[model samples]
Target chain A: DAGITQSPRHKVTETGTPVTLRCHQTENHRYMYWYRQDPGHGLRLIHYSYGVKDTDKGEVSDGYSVSRSKTEDFLLTLESATSSQTSVYFCAISDPAGGQETQYFGPGTRLLVL
Target chain B: EDQVTQSPEALRLQEGESSSLNCSYTVSGLRGLFWYRQDPGKGPEFLFTLYSAGEEKEKERLKATLTKKESFLHITAPKPEDSATYLCAVQATGNNRLAFGKGNQVVVIP
Candidate 1:
C-alpha cells in the first residue's frame, strides 16, 4: 500500500446520501489521484491533485468532487451517492522526479450504495 | 482519446509454467507504460514502467517489454503465489492521467 491509507475500508450507504472518502499519504508525493475500480472497467480516474489546493477532473469525474487541503490529504466526495457509484475506490500517489513515474496505491475503500 | 486494451480476461497456468500477458494501447503520444499486480481486496502494486518502444524491465521472475503499439508482461516459471490480477496502464504525453486496461486475472495452480 506504500505510504498511503484510505479511510472507511468498507461502507454501505443509501442512495441519494452524501459520502466522503479520505486518502492520506505519508510519502509527501506531488501527485494524488482518485480512481474507481469496477467489474469490466479496470480503474477509472475520478480526479487528481497536482499540489495542495490544486485539483483537476479526470476521465470519470462526473458526480464526484475532490479536495486537497494539505499535502497529505485528498478527499473524494459524492454529493449524492448513486447505485452506479458503488465500487472499490483507490487512491494513488506518484512522484515523477528521478524517473520515478510509477504510482503507488493505497489499500482501497469499498463503497456500496443501495 | 487514449485507450488501453488487455487480452485474455482470465488465465490459468500450472505452477512453473511460463506465459505472457498483452496490453495494447492507442494514445495520442506515449509518455510511459506501467504494469501493476493486484491482490484480491487490495490496491494495485507497481511493478515496472517502460518509457519507450523497445524498452524492457525485469523483476525476479517477471519481465516487461514494450513496443510501439503494445506491451508484454512475461512470467517465467511462475509460482502459485503469483496468482493475481495484472493491470496495465498508459500515460499519454501532455496528460497527467493514466488510462488502464480491464486487467488479466491469473490463477497459477500449484
Candidate 2:
C-alpha cells in the first residue's frame, strides 16, 4: 500500500554465491531500511539509508551490504551466501521530514541458501 | 542497549472475546514505540505509534496504550481476522534505528 516493491520475491542460491535483492519505492520517502526476519529473532535491521549515498549499519549487518544511489532504489547484497543467511528480507520506507517515524513495509523477499 | 520484550509468546481467543498483549521495553531515551501486525508470509503492517506516557491510540477494535516502561494492545470483541503475529518495536531518542521484540502470536477461533 506504500508503493514499495521488492524484486525477486523468492530466491534459492548455493553457498558462496553472491545474491542481491532490490527494493524500489514510489513514495519519494527519505528513509529506507532493509531487515531480515527469522523464527525467534523477529525482524532485525540489516542496513538502512537516510539519503542518496548515505548509509549505515544496523544490529545485524554482518554478511550483508547495502547501497542507495538514488532516492527511489535501495539494494541489499549478500557477498557470499550462507545457510544462516536464509530468511525473509523486508524493505521499508519512512518520511522524517513530517516528523513521522512510522515505517511502511513492502511485500518481502524469501531467500534460501543451501 | 535498548531491549524490547513481549510476554505470552502465543495466545488463543474465541471470536467476540476480549484480550490484551504486553510489550515491555528499556531504552536510554524514549522517542517512540510502534506496534505492527504481520500476517503469514508477509511483511509487517504499521498499526500505531505512541510517543509518550499516558497516550492512547485506536483503530477499529484495536487500542494501543503506552506508559513509562511498557505498552499494551487491547482488543475488544475480537474476530477471526485478528489472528496474526503482533510485533512491538522501540526507537530511542537521537537514534533512527528500532529495537524489536520477538512478537506475540494470536489465534482467534471463529
Candidate 3:
C-alpha cells in the first residue's frame, strides 16, 4: 500500500464529463490493475495492464479505459462519467516473480458523478 | 466462472471477543487465497496470503487458514480498531485475474 499512490483522492464530476484517476507506484511492479468497489457487489476489475501499452479489459470494462505509458504510472479514464460510475477506485500491483504473487493496493480514489 | 462468496454480511462483537469469518470460492485451480482489511473511506490493506490447502498464517490477533474450497479468518480478542470490512480474494491459475468477495463487515465495540 505504501508503494502505490492514487491521485485525486476524492473527486466530484458532472455526468458526461471526462475524468481520469491516476495510480503511481514506486515499486515498478509489472502487473497493474484497476478495480471499483461498490455496495452489494464485490470489487470488480475494470482493466489491467501487464506492461506499458499492453492492456486488457476485465468483467466491467464497458465504461472505462486504461493506459500504462510507463512502468510507474497507470491511468484509468472515463470518457463519459455517469452516476453508475460513482464508486471508490483502487489500484493494485503484483510482482509475478515472487512465486505466489500477492497484490498490493493503493489508498483509493473516491469519485462521485452527479 | 470463478467466484468468491463471504458469509455474515455484518458482525458486531464486544472487546476481547473472538470469531471466525468464512469465505467460499470456486475456481478451476486455486493459486492463492488472500485476506484484506478495508476501513471505511479507505482502500483495502493486504493481510495474508494462503497458498495451499491446510495452510495457515497469523498476524497478531488475526489468523487466516485455507482449505480446498474455503478460507477462514479468525480474530482473537479483537479490539475496537479492528472494526472494518474483511475481504476475501482468490487468484486462479486459469487466468491472471483475481476474484474478490463482497466482504464481511466487522465491528468490534469497546
lDDT of 2 by residue, B3-110 (tens): 999988999999999999999999999999999999999899999999999999999999999999999999999999999999999999988889999999999999
lDDT of 3: 0.93
Candidate 1 lDDT tens digits, B1-110: 89999988999999999999999999999999999999999999999989899999999999999999999999999999899999999999977789999999999999
- lDDT (0-100) at residue A47 of candidate 3? 98
Candidate with the larger DockQ of 1 and 3: 1
User: Against the true structure, whose TM-score is highest?
Assistant: 2
Q: What lDDT does the true structure give each of the candidates?
A: 0.94, 0.95, 0.93
Report, to 2 decimal places, the DockQ of model 3: 0.89
Top candidate on DockQ is 1
How close is chain B to the truth by TM-score, in each candidate?
Answer: 0.99, 0.99, 0.97
Error of 1 at A97 (Å): 4.6
Worst 10 residues of 3 chain B by lDDT: B89-98
Better of 1 and 2 by lDDT: 2
Which pairs clash in the backbone of model 3?
none
- Candidate 3 residue-wise lDDT at A71: 95
- The TM-score values for the models, in the order shown, are 0.97, 0.98, 0.97
- Residue A34 lDDT in model 3? 98
